[model samples]
Target: MEWLLTPGPVQLHPKALEALSRPQLHHRTEPARALFLEARSLLKRAFGTEGEVLVLTGSGTLAMEALAQNLFAPGERVLVPVYGKFSERFYEIALAAGLRAERLDLPYGRVPRPEDVAQRGFQGLLLVHSETSTGALVDLPALARAFKEANPEGLVGADMVTSLLVREVALEAYGVDAAVSGSQKGLMCPPGLGFVALSPRALERLKPRGYYLDLARELKAQREGESAWTPAINLVGAVKAVLEAVMPHLEAHLALKAWQNALLYQVGEALGLRPVPEVKSPAVAAFYLPEGVPYGAVKEAFARRNAVIAGGQGPLKGRIFRLSLMGAYDRYEALGVAALFREALADILPAS
Candidate 1:
């Protein structure tokens, strides 16, 4: 109802909404199997990979957890490049999954060059291709190459949830071992499906781990057109509808990114709210507030104007607010949000 702006729950298409209302099919039904298989096939194009695409019913983070569980065993050393909050997650997931994670820390606004991975020789690497918190997009391909050079036999997992379709990433071409993404963002679907794709090398590297989040078992079941368990039938249908109808226009998506970010940059310049210089992402814009204005005031200003946006996360909380343009954001809609942003920012700036 309100001008939908935050990243995850984007404006759903009427068709997708209708798909949710379709009769729930048994997970093993012939029709469900057909749609399920179709969605998996579509994901390969979505991720630019010919490898198996695993569609599991969970949040995007679950895809990361699945990789952590199956790919690395306890005490195996992994490298995590931490610059933003989401990147820090790799370290946490690694620790939780029993892998010993070493980190290459960079300043909040800075990005590590892709070749930086070649300098480290950890057994595996958990890389956040897109730093959601800081709106910094990392160089995934370079990192992938460097990882191979440094640890040819080790694994490399990418969290592509925010960057998957916003830009061009060839998962299979880049030789990345595994990657995770979600139904939300570029896919423009509801938030119930977590998608993963793995290279043959990644599968070979996977060791025995947890059961439910197991990618191997899920892949086998998915290939047969059924989930290993009761799936999110309606949500999967939504994914099918959106991917079939919306996600193919890569050029349009790139233009959408450009349009939204151009407006954001204009508004930011007017208000003197600047994104961190070096590594801004196409998916979202992260900007610091005007001097002396609290984070709550900016949020309140948008609320009063019939709009809402995202706040900062972790240590960056209270310092930056994120405007996500990942899903279903149109030029006109973004312009309207920019208008509201200008007014809100004007009110928050110091009376000089």
Candidate 2:
């Protein structure tokens, strides 16, 4: 009955878990190839794109690195809209790639506006669709359109690690040249599978810097029912199960998220806690701590109950806490989390 309601590496679906425990299948086998390709098609639907989807053996960050390596040419200038920890990672990634990366640092929980970088003459725009640290979901379509309008020659890239399946987004419609996601989040599978869906334009032309993450090579291999290297067969199996058994119910899943979001907000308000002031996320809810409450103490309290939620990160640390209702979670699990959170809050911030 213990719940793990943190953002990434969420609770796995029963079927995915069961599938993960099965014996490995050779990566190049027909059955394995079919599973991998099937997962890709499911992922295309998840991303709402007819574009090419490539899966790699790494975390979501790996896909981000792949995008930076492949897309950012040396001496290129890129715009990153920063609001939380993950967004900061993109800025850092661009800098590490030796690109002239500039960012519009906005307040936490605030979505970046289209006008924020209207005149920025950058060659690319990097964005995180959901700021997990602050539990904020940005207007990705608007930002993508804005970037496209401002710099038609430039490309739009998105990190959908937290939003891929749990949140609604159409990569093609949003003009996202590349979008990255991980199995640990919305896909409700084991960690290690990183996915990137690329528009045809991006696929036709990208100078990948890294040998391991060459989308050209990976895509070719995948198309031929192969891998560039030994694949993570177990994790791929888990993802295949997720794609087969879970993703088909996307509408119901989204409805469940909406319901959970409203219920959590109602529960938090009843306990005198409030979400960060902005357009909150349906996947993760970041709540401002009550006055006189100690963050570490409350986190430890949850741990003592054999459950683990997340404390905020970076600038929001110790002030806001996050709860993720991703993966195979439902109202029954929500009720458990709510009860534990209530008890912990009462213990930490008793009537005053």
Candidate 3:
């Protein structure tokens, strides 16, 4: 059995794998449309939104591009809160799409305060609900209130790629205008399928259809119970199966995550390992290496024992290591991984 601890492309449930192996269906066929509609309905329930859900055959980045390309006109200004690698990408995509983008940079492992964004005037606001790279969780409700108060015209958007099914986002209740996620993260399916939900007010900001990334066309096709282009039949089928299986047990899934994180923290404390922050994510836990111990040595030592742990991204590389507790992980698995990590660290850096 391969143990995966990385963020995206997380460990898949056996049922989801079985769903992917089912007989292929044509995208234009009646069965395909029914499946598409079923998936869309389930997605709404998953996102806890009454707004429209758009299914795309690309990654989560495609959903982001679609929103940027269709929602705003040229020269529109957007404010992106940059805390990790994925959050920073939102700014890059908006700029590349020809929109005026400004960034509010926050150090990794710390959430941005609402007052910080309230000072900046912008038409659109972007957030990464869970920054997997840094294991930082933003306060969605506070951020939404601050953005709306800062600029009434601002449409709030979030990248829920890492937090979706694992945590409670409640986009409608939280005042989020638009949000996006991929199938692989919390949805417990494979990559290649992107999910997007937009508020009616946010949808009203769209310009005329100019490209395939147009949300208008996607929405129109979705209204007819289909996708604009041929859909990813296998992946959509997997998503439908996964959602059906997990919907009733979502709370249990999140509880398992909590249990795993707590177990990891217990083991880390016993082993004298330092957590990166006082507030840790239930989705993932990032730890700082003991002083005088290099991250590379610890990573290789873990790899030798057939366990995979993630290293930090961008500037934090070589300074920290991340272990994902999302998906179907259990307390035993968490304990095993924690033992392996502690053993690895002990081998690399002895007590002094």
Candidate 1 residue-wise lDDT, 79-100, digit = tens? 8888888778878988999888
Clashing pairs in 3: none
Best candidate, TM-score-wise?
A: 2
Candidate 2 lDDT tens digits, 1-352: 6678788788888878898778878987899888888878888888888778888998888899889878878789999988999999999988988889998899977888888867558889999998888888888888888887889888889999988877687877888888999989988887898988888778866877668888778888987667797888788888878877766688888888767766777777888897983887788878898876768887887788887888888889899887778868877877777787777777777775
- lDDT of model 2 at residue 336? 75
How many pairs of residues in model 2 come into backbone collision?
0
Residues 61-104, candidate 3: write the lDDT tens digits. 99888777777777889988888888889889989888899888
TM-scores for every candidate against the unseen true structure: 0.95, 0.96, 0.94
Off by over 4 Å in 1: 350-352
Q: What is the total number of backbone clashes in candidate 1?
A: 0
Residue 221, candidate 2: C-alpha displacement in angstroms? 0.8
lDDT of each prediction vs. the true structure?
A: 0.79, 0.83, 0.81
Candidate 2 has an lDDT of 0.83
